[model samples]
Target: MPFILTRITRDGLSRLMAKYVVGQIVCHERGWMDTHMKQIKKDCIGWHTFHSFRSLDQLTVGVMGLGKIGLTTAKVLKGFGCRVHGLVRTPRSHSSVEPFVDQLWHGREGLADFLKDCDYLVNLMPSTPLTHGLLGDEVLTGASRRPVIVNVGRGDIITEADLLKALEQGWIFAAVLDCYEKEPIPEDSFLWTHPRVVMTPHNSYNNNEDYKRHHIQTEFIVNFENFLAGQPLTGEVDWQTGY
Candidate 1:
């Protein structure tokens, strides 16, 4: 980390400083901590290990949706040291997370298991008719503990009420949400006011920008190279599933 040169909002010096630093500068608004007391509180807790925190040690991390981010997150957790469990509609659909997860559960039955005690349970599904409010009272109220409740998928999957109940009931230790049911989230929404909640503007792929950009560029480069070489293009598309 390097020194930060901050200025009053009216000075416009921040923008001037930004031009000079380019990617090196990371700016934050003033009174950021006041806006992030829950995180401040959650971080205040000392780090613990599985052996020490028996419950934490046997962390049964659950992923509600094994989509791109969810699958990748499960993989990372497994590699960094954690037991993973995944839930999806079809057992055969998600082979990417298979090796990382200790177990896989499907359908309502499998989804029910996600409510059980776990160190972390992250929802990385989407916001479709079938997924709306999916994490209602049944799953939210049933969880053994909050399990560090995190929702990176769509916000509406779990209603605001359910989230409140989970916290009030001690279903989980903390809440970290990147996306919410309402984009930009209502200024007065409880998601911000909740004592256990941590909110972000959906930056899960922050570190993947270069990889993403390269892939797009590669797609174009590959096709152009193939044309020059007189070779067939190599890309599959399943319009039916929209993948």
Candidate 2:
């Protein structure tokens, strides 16, 4: 061990103030933790704990899309302690989901600023013709601060190249990927090597299989009632949007 090590201490900021170091390491003369409190705070990030930012006080969380899961996740986070915002197309409708979002933004350029203050970015956008490769460099460009990204939606929404660039270039702080451009991410893939990245098969929103019969019966009952009433069927497919 080098005795030439330099130990510096100051009181500009308290250790309890940091998000990473949760409380102080208490020292006990017997089996001691060697606890000593001095203000030498560097910076706290990705800290989740009792005294960490996990409690969500003063935390900004942004959801990229306002779909079922997205809206639910935002609301759940708010119940805990975070300020939740949503990115939806402009002129959103009034709903319980709206109240959950502290703010809303629309379009790609809007995303840049919408995510500026966010500590966590939850992407729930569906993969469509326009949304294929949406999270490319143009959108990830100039992000003021890196935020932890959790992608529970379609993978094609974010391109393989763009996701690679985002990680290597530090556009996003870290990622929790449950889907990908390729289902079987190649053994040679960059995502496998990236230390800050987490990967999983697309299974976050597992369908309720036990309700399969109920779902079928429910749909049939509604449509059957409409048929009996001689009314137009609901859930007409949108050929143009291919929904």
Candidate 3:
């Protein structure tokens, strides 16, 4: 391990912040801002449409990946009075999960059960061969709660075709997507016009304060200092796992 020199950046903080921001947007249904503005402009005071929404306390947020980012997200969501859950491949003891969430579902066999009652879903997994089309028709169909899918993870995890179908049929409530299979989503893509969807240009990890605070370099410096002092460095990469 000493043979390799690596650095820690704002990966964790960025992802953690992204999850919190996305969760707030989804839970508060802020995606309809444009539509609401248009309605307000259409009529000065006559036309009124009210939306029934639930508080975060009344909803369960399911995190698809139990990694650092997902765990941080879940922990933060807990502060907001929301119940958090994680999806795992197997029942394993994780320090991060213990303090954050009590409910966890295992693998494909457990995904359906995990999604059955979740009010919101957050994705933080990377794109991998085993993850391609992971959230397909069957998975989406199994989601009976009509949860909002907030994907800060890879876009390929949920095929656009299947996602569109799910949205059309109302299998899920809505989607808040930050990443896409296609980076610059095509100009003609229907998602751009989808009423129930909120799309960001893979900018979920961006925060203006990050630069002002020098967060990335600060993390690296702290980790480097710890390494020099023979203290355990945070955000150390595991080559075997490529994390």
| Candidate 3, 178-229: lDDT as tens digits | 8897878988888999987878777766668756368777877887788889
lDDT of 2 at 165: 82
Sort the predicted structures by TM-score, highest score first. Answer: 3, 2, 1
Query: Who is ahead in TM-score, 1 or 3?
Result: 3
Off by over 4 Å in 3: 1-23, 26-35, 45-48, 89-91, 94-96, 209-213, 220-242
lDDT of each: 0.59, 0.60, 0.75
Quote the lDDT for 202 in model 1. 69
Evaluation by lDDT, superior candidate among 1 and 2: 2
- Give the Cα-based TM-score of candidate 3 against the true structure: 0.80
Q: By summed lDDT, which 10 consecutive residues of candidate 1 come out lowest? A: 20-29
Choose 1 or 2, whichever is better by TM-score.
2
Instruction: List candidate 2 segments past 4 Å from native.
Output: 1-53, 93-97, 207-237
What shift in Å separates residue 84 of candidate 2 from its native position after superposition?
Answer: 1.4
lDDT of 2 by residue, 1-243 (tens): 322111111211111112111111111111121111112232234122123223455567787777555666666667656788778654565464667788888766577778778767777776667567767765776566676677766788777788778878888777777778887888888888677676656655333565534554566677668778977665544444433
Tell me the spans in candidate 1 whose CA falls farther than 4 Å from its real position. Answer: 1-57, 93-97, 207-212, 216-243
